[model samples]
Target chain A: MKYITHSLVILLSFLIWAGTAHAVEKTSGQSRLPVTESMVNQKFIFIGNLIKRSKTFKNIEAHGDEDVFEDIANVKALYKKAELSVQQGDYEVANNLLNEIVKLVTSITRKESKVTNDQTNSLRYYNERKATIIALMKTFDEITTNEQTANESLEPRRRMVDDFLNQAKSNITNGEVDGAIVNVDKAYDVAIRITIEVRDGITLIRELNFETAKDEYLYEIDRNDSHYFLLDITVKEKKPSAKMLLSIQKLREESDGMRADADNEAKSGNYEAATDILNKSTKNLIRAIRMGGNFIPG
Target chain B: MKSGYWLFILTICLSGSGIAASFAQEYDILHPPLGTEGIYDPENPGIEYLQQPSEALSLLPSSPTGNYVDWVKAMDDSLIEPRASIYGDQIMRAISMDVIMQQTGSMPYVRFPHYDHSLILSCTNCHTAIFLPKKDANPVNMYTILKGEFCGVCHGKVSFPLTDCFRCHSSVRDKRVLDE
Candidate 1:
């Protein structure tokens, strides 16, 4: 009974974690700024996430199309470029652009937030600030884009990777293995790493770091042809965190049905339905809680 | 020096956008730093990346021991990607929540989707502070009824009008229609 209970507990947690774990792990393409050549972690990875949902956060109050200015503007423009690339079958370009937006947004937010005055009227300049979130919402309304991808209450980095995975999977299905590999490779590197020491003699100190793996991979891509994805995948070598694997598995699970639905739905010109089915397949995944007393009022 | 560099980098990022959505909004206690125009100015108090010498230097993990620096660096290095060993409470909550989201197909909790980090405003945003930087810490309050706390704070507001009871309490037993 005890062992059965424990197994149930573990499975339940994995399902929960799995929903949040899947985000893009890798970034590819020989792309450039307005997007890249910027710091991802350095940007506001989570900035304006809530602001976008703010009722007061209007897309435009006065002089413009909300998304064409400041940081929010940059994110939208970048996301737009990425989407266009994907549409045009330029996965490499899409990869770089997306990476740029994620990094730039995250990096900029952290910097701005720390310096921001947490005032009673955080919406004082509700005009400008809110505009930022609203603009991104309009431009990149993708599944995990500004509006839909707001509740980061769960594990965010994991979701970041998961979003990437979904994007990559789309590329893979279209036989864009290079593009898919580029995307997954980024996710893999970003999500895994092995510690090493350099100086006299490079001693690979044992440590699997997500940032390291990402940096090392990014470093490689940055050095060589940014488009050439180093295809040396070994799940055993890096050993994805249970969290990541679960996310991937969940995405894979939902995708099977989603793929079929997406294909047929698109054939019918139901982009919204196609997207909804795909999103629904990946979203609302918390329902997999195998019925049992994983939750007993203690 | 380490925290200073981090702050410096952070300042540049925040000025470019908004702030405190993902990490380090603990300073919200000192509310209303300045008007948007003033802080956004190149020559303002917020402009200079205040170099408060962080005591975290000692916490920095040396060549290869176990300390705060190493932990953060490891995270920076993406070392913690695979370990998803959750606790009993986390598991229970996940199970309960997943069932709720699955059934509803659309809930405030699912709207946030975890990595939506910027949505968080306080430390108690998720766990009873269970999700801390350090793994082994005091057990976050679970059973105690928290009012206006993490999930409670926004559930009724921006996240997803949590007026619907069944949206969260999965095992509420009486599965009839909820009074909106």
Candidate 2:
């Protein structure tokens, strides 16, 4: 009887221990199964859709070169492997593969961004240089024609600038942006040099023909405004002496009065008188600017 | 006696298995055990664990105030390239016009260079919204600017601080008088 009791006690204890252990194991395994499976499925679908709809991916497809193409192909292959891993219930492997795909795509996008930015910069620089050269050419023509100073020496330089500009345009048509920029820069240099030489040359032969007094008045206004701007820049830069400052102040007051008189004349429809008064105002400003130790043409 | 012992053993075994199974079913991946819900899980993370601006902005050029990064310089230096549009491959067209604003006081006039702004922004960003295209339409004063109007909208908010005055008030005052 004692033996039977001992046997029954041992059997009961073993059954309890075994039952608990097996229940814990079964619960842990089953708990992870559904969640892992669903999560893997969702992530796979998400990444796949992301790749398909990504702007970077589309940009690469449209503009990617051979090396970029290879990188994108590798991304596709890794994505497929991640999909297979998800199907096989290997969530860990699938997650790692998906991460690799993301890294690869990120690197590709970064490279593409640089390429696009460089292209944009090149085109913008070319356009800016082109516009500057054209404006400089107009200034060169106006100064040469109005002053009639050293035309014999300037015409050749003018033709050279025109040739450079034409070359720049042709280079742009051929998709050589760097070449275009170089040509445009050369054209600008020549054109600006020609204008500066003519304006600075002491030949005071101003034969400007304006169709209307208002037109000449408008021109004088622009001239006065520019001189005023130059005077301001020079004073801040040069920091002239007190004596020079006093002289500048007196000149400035006179110029201001003249400017007011000119504006009144213009309002009263006496544009010719306004033009003369404005020109005098500009000459005073120029003298004051010179007192500040700066040399600018009036 | 043997039969009663067998019956007792059988009852204990059945009850022990039932209790163990029920306890196991109480916890799972979705329904975690009580008191363990707040614990960090490696498999699943919250949004707080993702990349934050504080960490990312450190990589860009640092500024004194307003914007943490010098965004315009960053773009110019090729440190960052932000897309101008989301729908297509659009680029910003830089306008190279300079507009001079006459000052009321003795301060130098403000020369607003459209090239700098238009290089990064679209015309619609400020036109018809913050400023009218027409001349003198927007009465931009320092008081209004300091109060977060006109240039202040971006200057003290995202671009740079307002304390740097010489940057905008660059054109000097012309102090010259004309001869009779």
Candidate 3:
């Protein structure tokens, strides 16, 4: 009993330490998306919580709907797969799988609204999954942004970027959102590689092209301001959570700052830098719209 | 017949209002056909049958369930069964059964016709999965059904709204009425 107690204390202490470390690192922003041991541990705890919540939802057991049962089984399998991926240190795959599980669980809950006797338990489960998905998305966003920044100084892998971008676009058109995301991630990875074999970098013609693209974005930002206002009104009317509203606000501010930076850089004849800033700003805006604009009707 | 004239008037009115009463009749491949009710609202007076009671059936004094029963009897079994399968298997074995719910006073008893559903869905769709094969095993209520737990799973999202009470609760307990 003494040995067991001691072991428990040690484990608890380690978890607390990890949590503290993760919080500190996040605030510090040492690396935009440093996938720490704590994040993986948190995921494991969430998975455990989900299992407990599923048990509380006795409908899955009491009811005999094959589709419902199949869905539950699929979620469980996904959770296991995510855990395995985490163990193998494949954080991206793990996170993607976790995202899938989150989407599936949330969608199921949405379809079968208030069916569970324990509404509180079901809600908690849904909220926890949503929170985890947000964390994963944030981490990926930061990683992509930071890595893209680093890759800017390298020789432009234009061909690779074009190919990946095309593939991503096609995937999106085909309604393969996950597949599109994966392709975009790959494109970013390829585009950012600072190769040792440096040829002539930042030609004048390329600079002119980037400047043109930057100007187009500036026009877009101005045009989209009206859309943003419309979205804000709609979102407010819908009475979204304070947290969602806050996220939208933060993204808008970030986009504004990036736009300003891009404008200044372009004026100073550093088109490449300006373009990069503009690109980041555009991405931030897109992410903002995607997250909050789900309520907006077509 | 007067019914034929009413049908023509209804068609003209619906077309004039620019509501696709015919277009919506096209069975959604995404959500399987469960049946619909022709809602009569004085505020919006128009023939409102989205996917149930058949496009052929007109809005008459008869209950939507009665219309559904008549439609099911006349409908080709192969048309609704062969193409659509929301739960995997396309070849669904039809089972005919009725769940007679005991309701008091003006509240009509629920006559759950498995025959109509089985035309599109298999026995495994609800049996032992959503509902047990035994009678009165599942404690079903309007509140729970509205929450998409039991019948509401298919009804509101794909089929039709539960606002039309007579659609499902069309069973008459009176011996003479039931015999007719």
Best-performing candidate as measured by TM-score: 2
Runs with alpha carbons beyond 4 Å of true place in candidate 2: A1-47, A55-73, A83-96, A99-125, A136-161, A173-178, A185-298, B1-167, B170-180
DockQ of predicted candidate 2 = 0.04
**Taking chain A of candidate 1, what TM-score results?**
0.20
Candidate 1: tens digits of C-alpha lDDT, residues A144-262: 33325434442354455556566666874675545655565444332221100001111111121325433333222221211111111122323556775565456446645665676
Docking class of 2: incorrect
Model-by-model lDDT, in order? 0.36, 0.70, 0.53
- Model 3, range B1-180, lDDT digits (tens) per residue? 679657755654544333333334335223223432223442321222223333334332222331232334344532222444567533443444455665212246677776578666633356444664433356565545655778878875666445445667676656456545
Q: Rank the candidates by DockQ, best first.
A: 2, 1, 3
Q: Give candidate 3's whole-model lDDT.
A: 0.53
Task: Give the interface RMSD of each candidate.
Answer: 29.7, 23.5, 35.2
Candidate 1 chain B: minimum summed lDDT over ten consecutive residues — where? Answer: B90-99
Residue-by-residue lDDT tens digits, candidate 2, B83-115: 767965655556555566653233466767766
Clashing pairs in 2: A251-B176, A251-B177, A252-B176, A252-B177, A253-B177, A254-B178, A255-B177, A255-B178
Task: Tell me the TM-score that candidate 3 gets on chain A alone.
Answer: 0.27
The candidate 3 chain B region of ten consecutive residues with least summed lDDT is B42-51
lDDT measured at residue A271 in model 1 versus the true structure, 0 to 100: 58
TM-score of each model's chain B:
0.20, 0.58, 0.52
Provide TM-scores for the models: 0.17, 0.35, 0.25
Which candidate's DockQ is highest? Answer: 2
Candidate 1 residue B160 C-alpha distance from true site, Å: 30
